[model samples]
Target: MPAFALEAEQRKWCEELRTLAARELRPLADAGEEGRINRELLAALGELGLLGRLFAPDGRPASALDLCLLRESLAYSCTEAETALALQGLGAGPVALAGTDGQRARWLTEVTAGRAVAAFALSEPGAGSDAAALALDAEPDGKGAGHGWRLTGSKTWISNAPHADVFTVFARTVKGAGSRGVTAFLVPAGRPGLGGEPLEMLSPHPVGTVTFDGVPVTRDDLLGEVDGGFGVAMRTLNLFRPSVGAFATGMAQAALDAAVEHAGTRRAFGGTLRDLQSVSHQLAETATRVEAARLLVYAAAAAYDRGEPDIPRRAAMAKLLATETAQQAVDAAVQIHGAAALQRGHLLEHLYREVRAPRIYEGASEVQRSIIAKELYS
Candidate 1:
């Protein structure tokens, strides 16, 4: 096999994951209530030992390529399972990367075991793509011997907000410092003054809003250096962005497979759909795009694993291209399937909804373009 291709072991692992997802995870995902945390699915992930793979145990960083492969394989058969795994990594990433040994011992183990749900709370009502502009304030706790801070603000669109056992919350610690003022805190769900409510969304996931009305945090809660949380957040995003692209590519592959299968069987105008030049050409274009996107995703993941300096540009390009391509591929799949694809519970219908959110989250396509352009000039 070429260097770009998956090694035999990697290919076998991916196939096993797909089989596990289809046979075990997909049923739990289907039974899960929309907009709610699927603890059962998470527990299943832990039971299968897959959750432990998200973090390296030897005091080394997790491989970005492994992350991408896991996500893509799980996403190919069970997007809900893939999402549960990714959310755990995203929420606990700061702690896994920068938390104190005590913090790691307290949270990381439980997170890996799926006994504790975690959330990454960075985006606020005013922040979103402008993450540095987050307004959640963490004022010094004057009455707590100056050893703690009181958090007061709201975070919107936080995945696993309402149900997560702990959250890596970002708040402003120094006024007028822009990104430098931010601090990341590990706030437990039962903390006083911390509250959350679920938000209904088109996609089936546990995303919601969190409100912090003077939630108190001590030095122990800090995930990284105070006033330097932005770096931690960026590092996590930089690592995961390409995997997000891989996730999108997996969905694209599934959609392409469905389209190809349908075209080969479904007849139109006295002949099979694949016999038509127009239908065949559309499928061909989508297949080419999906392969290109997958290659870009693989390259970005490999670069990240290698500790390459141009990771930001490569990751942005991978995510932007793959997500946009997934949307197009899924849309084309729907077009070929016609009205049957629109029916509830259809694979194409589910993918149609799932593929759109990736383009918007983990930094939008516009933000990605800006990052790439900046990298090019620098």
Candidate 2:
């Protein structure tokens, strides 16, 4: 399938997204750049319905192709902003898929309007790759009490914790059952006893630890049913994981762009760098790997758009292969740049750090490999 099959109008929208991002976000990545998701840029996206693009104009579930196209283009220029926007989509996406119409109209509306930021709160200090190992606890509140559920536990390394106005918190239901006992909650941040502490990482993205010390949640916010959260979270990932691949695609594209420019302009051995077989071969290899990765990602995304049966396996494969290839491509770009790209401020070096996070989060490389292997064997 074509990487993207777009009408002229959608093509214009994609161009606008890329052009606006470069004009606005590119400068934020330079010189001690916090790369924070600035308010104005976000509002601009909201104004164009980019923030609210997941839903169709008819107000139903969004087309997968549209989601992928917007995310892939956004990822190319600003990885952090891309991630932030993704968090907004993902945090409320589960409820949209599984929640009552009221839930989507309530939480998702604010998020799409840019009035609130949304986040998914599933990862814990101990449950990095093994999602089933999650240990946060949520028990039914006494019937006489005002609240329906009381959550008590700590979740570490959560994105948007510090800034999130609302979060989709997951917790264990009870001990008797395994996956059945796990439940998901829509918990607002700063609800009395909740706590958030920022985490420092290689990339300058917003991350923090969240703790719920007897946080109250209304029964109305329970996504799906008790223990139904497993499917909710998994299905959500199955849909959004390809965007992680898109982030990888962006890194690879950026790296390849840098390398090609350097190869044509830089001189060695009385010739342009590309004149050498070693450099040319590397260029060819980078190009080939990037195209391969792009195809894999696009195929998986296409499957999602088509409602194919094997989307989980396809998405996992796409996420893993695309990210690894993108990393390799970026590394090659850094190598090709020699010393110039090694500078801390260089785009390749910045992308080198930015790309590493995707491998570790949203289902790690090893985790996806295991999932794919299990699917293949079973």
Candidate 3:
């Protein structure tokens, strides 16, 4: 809230997390989207406390400033794998922030500990930026005994869906349709009639369509109040959307790093590529952008962690800068590497795809601008 910056403890955690991810997770980063995540990788992150950051020290952020730093570091090493790890916190954040104690102990604890994976099921074929347009339904059963409702309808483009053991799902509870009718649910995986099919997207992290048909849910499973999840989900996004920006900063930094290395080593016209003002200037500009974006994301993340009042505007700016900078940085890296950069097995190629998805997810870049403008105008 008051110009948040890194502390020694946050810096220490970032150093340790980067070492672990660079050692264990970075090597497996570009195994194609299908092979991106696994139990071993999850376990590795859990052991390093990547997943535990939100819950490890009394269920608050381990460090207000480290959220962006850790995510940036992880993204630099491996964005896809790192994002899956990061979402464990974001995906389950509504529960961590507002769940019933029972719900917290049941789903939140396990997800933080990496014993299970958590997912967010909010996007649908018809609803994304217009979250209020959600069509998923949660209705009281005709013969309700203990269970309060049954959720039905489909959610698309869900991250961590295939392997996730539970989901923080948003569905309609009141008879009225739209986001106002929505309520968040702590839906357990392997429940009867719950769907876990996968979808083919440009950049992948086990995303797909989740069809909930008469899935039994108890009153305790409802996150926030009836038709109150609109506020709950928005609050959760306010906490995480900046981290998505941090993830972008990490990626763009990676691209800058790649560009630097390539420019220094590769030769052009009987001289090193680094001698080219064009090449050197691009790398310099990208480096500057990465640092600026990283700082913006951190400032927003810390403000959110501190319960700052103007978080929506700051968070929107953070997301906007980080996501857009990541795309430009990766493109610069590709330019430095020429044709080789776009080849398979190249990190930038994968990053090129990975960077695009963040803008679309959390909220589209255009939507973020709209949000910031609306708030500023108001």
Best by TM-score: 1
lDDT of candidate 1 at residue 295, scale 0 to 100: 88
Steric collisions counted per model? 0, 1, 1
Winner on lDDT (2 vs 3)? 3
Rank list by lDDT? 1, 3, 2
lDDT of 2 by residue, 86-175 (tens): 778888788777887777778777887777877789899888787777888786788664548778888987877766888898888876
Number of the top-ranking candidate, with lDDT as the measure: 1
Cα TM-score of candidate 2: 0.93
What is the alpha-carbon lDDT for the whole of candidate 3? 0.80
Q: Put down candidate 1 lDDT per residue, 182-272, tens digits, no spaces.
A: 9999999899999989999988889999999999899889988989899999999998999999999999999999999999999889999
lDDT of 3 by residue, 1-378 (tens): 355567788778667767777788866654444633466667767776678766645554354456667787787776655876777887778887778777777776677667888888899889988888888888787664565888888898888765578889998777655666888888888887898677777885677778888898888788878779888899888878888898888888778888898889998898989999988888888888888888888888777767778888998999998899988999888988999988976788888878888888888999999989999889
Ordered by TM-score, highest first, the candidates read 1, 3, 2
Find the number of clashing residue pairs for candidate 1.
0
What TM-scores do the predictions have?
0.98, 0.93, 0.93
